[model samples]
Target: MIDGLDPEYLDACPAPNLAAMAQRGFRVNGNGMTPSVTNVNNVSLVTGSYPETHGITSNYLLDRQLGEEFYMESAEFLRAETMFQRATACGLRSLLVTAKDKLRRLLSDGATVSISSEDPPGWVVSGVGEPPPIYSLEVNRWVLDAGRYAMSQEPFDLVYLTTTDYAMHTYAPNDPESARHVTLLDEGLGAVLEQAPGARMLVTADHGMSDKTRMLHLPAELGRYGISARAIPVIKDRYVVHHSNLGGSIYVHLDESSDLNAALDTLRNLDGVEDAVSGEEAAARFHLMQERVGDIFVLADPSTVFGDPSEVAMPAGLRSHGSAHETTVPIFGCGPGLDTSTAARFRQNLDVGRYVFEDVLPPRPDGLLS
Candidate 1:
């Protein structure tokens, strides 16, 4: 999966290899699960379910009892089974290669081999040479190169490759750098196709990137009315260079003394807030984990973001995601089993995993096959 790929990027940038794959097979516009952030959608892709089932509502979570924050990057946080685990139960080997270690940790439950560019082992370094810095565009190429090398060494029944979104976050669709990045990805994809001649190829994105011009601190806004709260940006991660811990959606945790209705009304009337709803309403509408979410969910307009109150000045040329606007993603499938008729069934990004697990190699009712 391409981390931040969108339909506009594919259309504006020249990626002949990907275009050919879409032409030879089928290309359809599919929606991603909301809030459209990396961890939420990536987990949904692997688990073939929504956050309600997988229990990963955000990339970061708050422990209200302990008043501590932690990254939701561990496999233990997942409540649903992954496709890789199911494949293993079926006597099949799966390989997972990702640009970020967080994803490697989150989706490596039942993989025969798992590697990440962020912390490649000595063997991976030897095979692919030294990897580039995770913040650079070359790092994504390194991930694909490593995956190609691994596939050549051993046969894997299922192979999953995911890249980072540094280029997408830094460059606009019309920029020359964006075109170069797409070309690099195309070349890497072609190499993978050559290595596995008969393997089916499915490509999709975790979320789409959007240019954000405004940043809102919901907590500070509520403070004007003597309300105490904390606004957690759902897209916040260790990679601050990509987004500066700003995103289009935020979870507002109100103090016990705050008036919930008043806070919700104030947030809805904010300049950049597109929609504000109670936590229960948000969970039901978005299929999220209710307990993991906050007291209120606030969605910003496409051009705005949510950040800390101290972050008064918006970062120049900042691009981020985590809102309904980014739900639109392109889904491409090629090879024998996938055709126009089959592609018609895919309405969301998670459908890709469902197709592989339920349609391609479903679990037998009896038990593990010999």
Candidate 2:
């Protein structure tokens, strides 16, 4: 999975390798599930279903029972079977390589080999027999390097490699840094093609990217109406250096006596606030499970984002995405056995695993379904 690699950004970047690959195959704008957070859409890609089915609706979750917010990092919270699990049940070998440790745990439940960049020593030793620098701006490249090495040496029946989003989070689509990152990623894609010459590869991204020029403190705004609300940014993660928990979507949990409509109206009337809906309404519209959402859902426009009141300022050149405003991702296929006749048809993140399981690799002859 190419994390945070938007189709529009890809088009604007100077990556001839990726452009050529897209030309040889079919390319279409795939819709990401809302809110367009990384983990939410990544789970959607693997489970072939919406957040309502997989139960991971956002990158950060607010637990009513615990009265606390936490980053989502475990597959135990998933409500549906993943493509990796299904493949293993059918006696197919699976390999999972991720730039982030949390994703490895969340998606590697049934994989035969799972390596994460979080454990740099183990990852490098396993693949190249030597460890590189622990962490750097080129972490995504290292993950891809390991993936290519694995494919060349000990190939698996089903392989899923997820990259990092540091570059997309910090650079504009056409910026030199962004273009450089895309070029490196394209080279890694070429390596994968060489390693697995005839594999029916599906190239796609978790979510799109957007520029955040302003921050909306939803909690502070709700306080104007005497409504005490806890605003949980849906994009919160360990990688706060990227966006500082500021994103286009957030959840506001209100007290029992507060006027919900008044709060909603106050937010809607405010600048930068795009839409504010009740949790139930948001669940229905976004295909999210109601129980997992907060009391009120707040979404921002393309130029704005929601965040908690903080003394820390947003870093320069920060970019983020976690709302319907930037929900379009690119999905395509190349190599042998891929059908390009219906490439123009609309697709969503939920279709990725279904296509891979049903089209790329069908059920084994043993009829194993786990």
Candidate 3:
């Protein structure tokens, strides 16, 4: 999975390798889960399911009893079996190489070989050498390098490679920096193809990126309507340098004295607001975990992002996701036993995993014993 990779950006950028894959195999637009957050879709991609099944509906989770927390980096938040764990159960060795250590831990289950570009001293394996600096733009390249090294040392029946979205979050699709990073990513895929000649490879993203300029201070906005609400951006991370916690989706938990319908009406009238719904409606409509969502859910228009104004000021020119606008991403693959004949029938990001396990490999003699 490539983080924050938008299909629109693919058209603007030059990725000859990916373009070649389209010619040799198939490519189609895949729908990410509603609210289009990272943690939700990554779990979906691994489980061949949606947030409702995997129970990860947002990048930042809020449990009323435990307060709010970033959900993107934790495997404990995942409620379903990962493809790696499933493959391992079927007697297939699995390898997961990721740009972030968080994903390494999240995808690692059932003794799978897991390595990260963000590794510390003793965390990495022997053959898959140390990675480059995590903050560098070359971090994604570092992940691919580790994958190539690991593949050379031994063979695995299943391999998962995921990259960071630092470039996609900070640069426009046609910008020099973004182009350079994408070209490097494409070249890395070419190298992977060389190492595993007959391997079935599927490339997809957790969510797409959007250019959001205007910022809405949601808490303060709710205050104007005599509503006490905690407006939490659904997208947040420890690495705030890129997005500064501003995103297009916000979960609003109303205070005990506040009127829910009044706050929803006020939010719906706000400029740049796309849609606002009650928690129950949100869960049913978006397939979210009802208990984890707030009293009200807000989606910002494509040009705007929501954040707490009290947050340290955001730097100029940064892009972000975690919105309804970033739902469609490019999904494509090539190799023996990989079927693209039904490409037109493709739907959600979960289909990528379903295709790999069900079509590319031998089905479990009976049912998956998960």
Candidate 4:
């Protein structure tokens, strides 16, 4: 498996362990779901539904007020049904572990609390110095220590390691920085595998990352146009060919009126604009809900992103992930029944459940993981 998580970094993947895994199993070909963010993608994989059905479309989703803050607790997962819950209902041992704490709780609510996990976030915010959102190096240390402790105490039905994902978010795959992080993750996985050599060992990540230089400031740039909003949580990937003129504000409500056609026309006339797809179209494309996103969708060029919140030194534009652009993520496998050959075409991390476990629901750790 790739130590670093980002898909864009996958081309740089060594492909030995993963290729062996693919040789014995299936691998994904096309890019994963849009937004392709972690929390949204993991929920989709667990539920086998789109973000719309799962009701979570991002790692840092905006609440009704369009505030920058987002919920970071297992309780907020009341949004939709998850696969881990299904596993529990079926009496299967399901283990959900990740650098993201939100992912673990959403996957298996009220199970365990890894204050150091990569949930609620593992993000590098703009103003606040990027702290470890949920999982990261800290999680690796904690999980390794926890796993060893649990093994000594008793056997677990399932186990999860949640560091590789965090490593990728900061270092990205393929880069030297990523290599160091991936190596660290590999060490942890190696330990987990040694502990449970026979149990199904699944290695997968939510989405990939692309190393990019150009940054798009959606709020700052759009403000110049009548298309300004206090907020704009993109319902879709940042458009490469976009309507730079038709700026918009994102909220739980959609009320962009004042001659819709004119607004559409102005946006379409801008450079790098594909088409002013309505909220409905974006919902259909990204599998999001109408109530959760903005009304007007500004489709940008695939090559250029509209905005990214990761860059701190600048206004806002360093890395992005909201367009159809490809970001290579990892979906490696290690199990007895696993094929370990041939990568599955179009394997979204969301589809990882099927690969790891045979049953409809995932396996649990029987109090070992929590």
Best candidate, TM-score? 1
- Who wins the lDDT comparison? 1
* lDDT of all predictions: 0.90, 0.80, 0.80, 0.48
Pick the winner on TM-score between candidates 1 and 2.
1
TM-score of each: 0.96, 0.93, 0.93, 0.70
lDDT tens digits, residues 126-174, model 4? 2223334333454454445454444444544545444434354345454
lDDT, candidate 3, 56-114, per-residue tens: 77767768887645555677877877888777667778888888776777667753678
lDDT of 1 by residue, 307-332 (tens): 87576458988998998899999999
> Considering only N, C-alpha and C atoms within 3 Å, which residue pairs clash in candidate 2?
none
Q: Given candidate 1, what's the lDDT at residue 186?
A: 88
> 3 or 4: which has the higher lDDT?
3
Candidate no. 3 TM-score:
0.93
Write one digit per residue (lDDT tens) for candidate 2, span 1-370: 8888888677787766666666777777778888988889888888878888889988888999988777888987898778888887777888888988889988889888888877754645666654333234477777788887876767589888898787888788878887778878888888887778778777788888888788778778888778888887888887777778888999889888888888889888988988999999999999998888998998888888887557447656668888777888888777764557757543886677777767766665667552
Kindly give the stretch of ten consecutive residues in candidate 3 with the minimal lDDT sum: 120-129
Task: Estimate candidate 4's alpha-carbon lDDT, on a 0 to 1 scale.
Answer: 0.48
